[model samples]
Target chain A: MEQARISARQLLMLAILFEHGSAMVIPLGIDAKQDVWLAILCGMVLGGGLFFIYYRLFTYYPSLPLTAYSQQIVGPFFGKIIALVYILYFLYIAARVLRDFGELLLTFAYPETPLFVLNAVMMLTVMYAAYKGIEVLARTGELFFFSLYFTAFSGIALVVAAGLIDIHRLQPVLEEGWKRVFRIVFTQTLYVPFGETVVFTMLLPYIQKHEKAKMVGWLAILLSGLNLAFIMAINIAVLGADTVARSTFPLLNTIREIRVANFLERLDVLFMIALVVGGFFKISLFFYAGVIGAADLFRMPQHQRLVYPLGISVLLLSIAIASNFSEHIKEGLNIVTLYMHIPLQVGIPLLLLLFAIIRHRSSFLFRKQEKK
Target chain B: MAREGIKEIFDAIERNPQFRTTASVVIARKQTAEQLLSVLTPIDKIPANQMIKTLEMTETVWGENLNVHAGEIIEDFSLAGKEIVMSSFRLDRNLKKGQQQENVQFVRPPARLRASELAMFKNGKLVRWISGEEARGVLWILNKIKQTAITVDWEGKEESVSYKVMRAKTEIAAKMKKGKPVLTIHVETEGDVGEVLVPIDFTNPANITNLETKLRKEIKKEIQKAIQQAQREKSDIFGLGEVVHRSYPEKWKKMKQTWNEQYFPNISVHVTVDTFIRRTGLRSNPYFP
Candidate 1:
């Protein structure tokens, strides 16, 4: 039972930044090769459809968060278990994105810095933001969104002015054909950054205006999706599809190649800024969702006490997530995307929606039969 | 410019916006970095940025010289593991353009821009320089040819026909033939008759067709010469290796190790040039009968 309310605009900004997050820094959908942009567009379509399921569930229990509403849908015992699993899922993803940004900064800028140090600093900052409550986090997102796009657009302008883009690099479209593109769309792109918006279900009840929530959510998804696709296309066009696929961070490499008049080269800083801002918001939102959900399920009067413990766990979990950066990436792409993301983001929400529907229909039918 | 760590130079340029940057770097090999920088320092009396503008306006328009920035080198050689081929120039303070002043008390050495040479680099080391028709031939195969005036003999030694290339596109395809990679370079270009010293009537459609046939042969010869020079040097500057890598990733992984030394030097390449004389410029049939 949180009293703070955020406007629809803040919700939109948070979701957009959440979707952008580390997804922008790391190469997403690169398995599709030159048609990676096409795969992102396909993921957006699937993600948009998935949003409606969460939206309908929100409609069923508008006054309560997902953790509380699951109890009403099923019985108390099962709903508490589902809520606990979701809380753990949010914390897990928060840790994963935390590790992603930490690894990027370590590789690119801070080679000597320990991974734990980077993750700890980021986790501490996120803890502060989450402790401030959802309203402050949303407002912070509203402020950073403008600066994020400013760097993004200016970075793109420099790349174009440098004359690095080669349209032919994207040529022979679907060179390997549609099968690979769709496979990428379903496995990695769809569940990842896009379907990961399922974390927002815990925060939906905090919006000031419920009527505008659906539109804002969809708009944010569409805009962030297009932004990702456009950036990937530019990366492939500038660096070529093969180099892009091979790159650990394609966007970072793409920005590095932007040298307009020789004065504007070495612009990986802009990429770092964008990634940090994006990663901050992403980790904060998931951290907030997990904190509030845990509080709701545990019947705590205030969620503030739980933030520090959970934040420390996230920091530790990020470091303990994998042995090395490659293993971390591999586990995220191959193992986690299949095992954790699909089931929690897509499967459970969908089944919860189905059960909610059945409960509604059966109750209505019983009432009708009693009247007869 | 090539002596300094390309990253360090770029970082310095980025830190100070007032110093600004030019389109091309003066690459030197024989001289020390201090000598090259000092030689370029005084030449700033005329300002090289303005000179770059002049080159872009008069030279790049006519497609004689091109501007290759440091970023292209970083991307190609550092990121893509590809060779670098760009327009090369020698500082000739003696070579001046337009009219010369008469009996001047103090005459500053004029830095004229003339690009007849191409510098090729392999793994950050200067390999060799190719000039004359061979350089233009490389540009042709790379499809970097813009509006270049190609002069062809007409009627006799006194008369000539110069075709201006307005647009050009190069398509390179690698196909595995009998388990060996073969390359097909197709150059498609169209241009107008820029200057004609001959007395032929260009208004007639048949005459334009006849001129295109002759121009095609000249272009083919230039491209073949360039390709021959590249193969001889064992340099894959045209990024044919990249094309092969894109077409066949698994195969390239094996070929990449010995690409420049083994595969590129021995591979067979087929060149095709398609040319068209679209317009006859401002005047048709010339001023003569």
Candidate 2:
């Protein structure tokens, strides 16, 4: 039995690394076109509102992870099933992000390398991070946060210097009216990177200051929001929206365009380093959540023992999840966004929040009426 | 299950570790790049790097001495907009495109190899190559003129006057004329007399005005030649389509599909050149022996 704790800043870093984890690698909502920056802005503002709702739910059941409190909120049988689903979601998402990382490596870096090798390597590292516990993961995240920004900003600067960034490429802002921009904001961009932060609910209980977790959450959201907007803008400015939409790895393309004074060319390696570091944090946090949530639900003694089995399961699932990269991308955009992401990320948590308020505010009255 | 689809391979090559992401691309005349590089001299240096440098110099400083880089080529071909016109060039015994000076005495043997051509792309494929003044015309229309020369001949005079451009600015406006975009390009050039072989009054404002009109006309002719060549090749290397896209994004989406194929050739172009001669070199006329 262990109680792992992290500072509010570390929590923010974890949230940012997780939410921006996948978005940083792939093109974030390519359908948003030149207006993706707007989509990111809208996603953050709205996702921030939703995060407030999640925080409200967490505060009502202080210091208890979702697995522990779902039982108190709902009955035993329903709670176990809900907890199981949350555990599965944690494992599934960890696997999904793992797959995205693997595919990125395969598609961008190593074409000849086996996909399983890439997935397995990431899974093993995540397992190690999870075994070491949340503190190590948080520290690694902090280290990576600076590196990620440094790489991204330097890439942008080089791209600008190369005169590859044409502000004209980001033209015709909101050309389809506010309605079109808002649509993708909710449907596509909202789910993946923004709403995806819902998984962090499991980590919130470990915050040193539980009350300030909301503030940390907002800070994390705003930070990632601006980052997403800035990157998408650069992607459009350099690669243009059409190229970005077609390319599997738009950031890689954008970074590759960075030829500063000639010799600084092909800095996509820097991007690869940052994404790998970010993905490691994201997967580790998700892995930690899944192992802990499962142990808590089953009343298992040691969470560490669950790490290996769970990580191997994830590696296998990640390999079997989709046939290839395109299918994986399609599943993410289509199945994950509409089905798993919406209901779990936004819908279920929302329902839980509503249920918690009713149960707390009116429970005594209901019990009194029953006794009479 | 693994399928190495075309898309996947393309991405791998794009993000490959070995290839330089910022390497300059060369688009040749339906020929291997080696044949083009074969003639590019300075045998000790890499041909690709030299070609890239040559193309870069073509953007701002070079006139007949210029070359268009790979990045500029992509800008003209990118499908985000339709009215895109990029640089066009070629190579031979004579230095074509933006060749500036004629009489440079060689101190030593120059590089035997040279790559000087701007290959215009339409929809990501090479469409045509426009050389000499036409290629320079592309730069003028794009406002990429830093320093160039124009020789305006007086109708009755034997020797001509040459103006050296110090500053050049072009403003291209894309507006709707009927149902399509009508591009109006305005070019302002500031220069000074570099060579005056014919006798002319340096103090007289009338003569300066006279030379300025002749300079404007010459520059206009070059631009017109470029636009006409683009229309002939149906290449919008000028990025005129981008102007339309920025101004009217909603309409552009529908138009972007056919922009390079059908619309680019049909779009109307209006070009105006403004030349202001800042000063005359030292003496008004070439130093008479």
Candidate 3:
């Protein structure tokens, strides 16, 4: 295997997507109300713990991807089964991300452009970078990271500076009560983005030095968490709790309200550009990881060739899986939030950690007995 | 290692091919603009003098043409203008004996009046009437003489005698004293009589008490009427509604359910009145000077 190097910064970029994964749905805060930020904060704290678990796993098995390590730890057959399950999970996530990006573009930008064209264009870009290898992906992430942060922060500042925001809207704090807040934090926040950091396992092998990997991962998780919390707070302050809860894309709509001197209005174009670029990076990274995992499972000589086929498959899968945007959003919120998001994101990783710990303890006991 | 390299080459071939298409479109548009500009310049050139002259003429004519068009468009429409006058009139008219008359008083008689006076005096013994203390005494003596002569004449005639008399009375009281009755009489033969009353009881203690009581009652009624008018106008200057709304939001919400019926009726009201008499009407002294 070629040595593929990635900086701590690249890891931070990857962590941002996971940490802010729920951002796309933050606009739905209008439905969630005052509890939205609480949900986000809770997600961050819980997601940080999950990120730590992931970091521990990667630190324990430094050189191997999850696919090979699981097989070594558990028997080959069980390991293969688990690897297959992970492969499917990654591919599904890739497809969902593609669909999410496509839906956002279609809803906000070009209504007439076919989704296949958009997905294909994005997949091509991802495939090109993936072929160049993980080093290319990390470098690309590095190049875009600052611009991403600049666009995001400037957008928020513009919205805040518009002076239309009413601080009284956050009054009667915890109007929905703590129970709903806790439910949202646990059910809506922790499981989705925080747990999704499990994908970091694949990238850990490419890290240049393993010494500070855990610290880097923790810092990335924390920074991403704080960023999301700030975003949610701004959305609430700008749009009000009720409006934010009802909105499907709270941050985007908040940015949409940014107008400078009346002549420079409707800067949703800036947001759309940033979103499409950021979403491309996120989806492509997942797609590449899925292809590599699939190739690893089959013992294929090369994983790069699978990129196009998998991209096409995912593009079609995303289109066919949901009937329309409403259905997709509903499923994402109601069904996926409960089942796929909670169990896969949180449950599987916890189970894997438990298994790893039990195995470590038993091996320690067996080694002591042999020494005796 | 060779096989991995071969696989890598194959993977590269499998990547998306759309970037080339977009790049080509951008390149082509740039290339075509240069080609078009290069091809069109030399073939359609006119002399510079003619071109300059034509351009100048067009610029000069365009302004006039636009103005003419504007005038023609305006001519087809109707325009309207109006002048408004406002005036306020003051009327001063005196009613005397149910007849309208213009009476002029001269400070000094003109030459025509002197001539008319001399004509009147030339007929016989002259008689004149003037107004002052001396004239009032003379008028009294003449009135008595006329009355006596009329009586003698009537007595001598000895047919019949008819007398018409009228009387009026008012209750008068001093500021510190009790009430008193005052009477007035008028006697006339087919003539009109008029009299103005000068009330002398204003300073009486009884009259003062009555006036004070009446004035206080009238002030109270006036205050009530003003309050009723204010309520009818729905002015909440007293901030009663604000008090109720703030103190009881839920109750206010319920009250607002039928605000028109419940909130306006029997509304809490308070009023304070202060009165000062600066001057009395006409009679400052008990008797005429």
Give the poorly placed runs of model 2, Cα more than 4 Å off. A363-372, B1-289
Tens-place lDDT per residue, model 1, A53-142, is 999999888878889999888889999999999999899999999998887887667744667899999999999999999989998998
DockQ of each: 0.01, 0.01, 0.00
The full ranking of all candidates by TM-score, starting with the best, is 1, 2, 3
Q: How many Å off is the CA of B142 in candidate 2?
A: 59
TM-score of chain B of each: 0.79, 0.77, 0.23
Clashes of 1: 0
Give a tens-digit lDDT track for model 3, residues B126-179.
112112222211212111111110100122333121111111111111121122
Q: What does the i-RMS of model 3 come to?
A: 42.9
For residues B1-289, could you state the per-residue lDDT of candidate 2 as single tens digits?
0111111223444556785445454444333445545443442245556666666665556664344333443334344663333332234443331122221233322323343555565545555666678777887887777787777786676437877787788999989978888988899977667777766755445678788888888888999888888778776777778899899898898898788678888888888887876445323333342
lDDT of 3 by residue, A1-372 (tens): 225678776777766754554354345333347556666667777777887777777766788777777786676998888788887777787777777777676555654366668877776787787677777777777777777777787776677677767767767678878877777776666665666777777778878778878877777767876777677777777777655644446667777788867866687876775776667676766767777778888888687777778777877887776644444555676777787777766776677777888888899999999999
Error of 1 at A234 (Å): 0.5
Poorest lDDT segment (10 consecutive residues) of candidate 1 chain B? B96-105
Q: Rate the local accuracy (lDDT) of all candidates.
A: 0.79, 0.74, 0.51
Every candidate's fraction of true contacts kept comes to 0.00, 0.00, 0.00
Docking class of predicted structure 3: incorrect
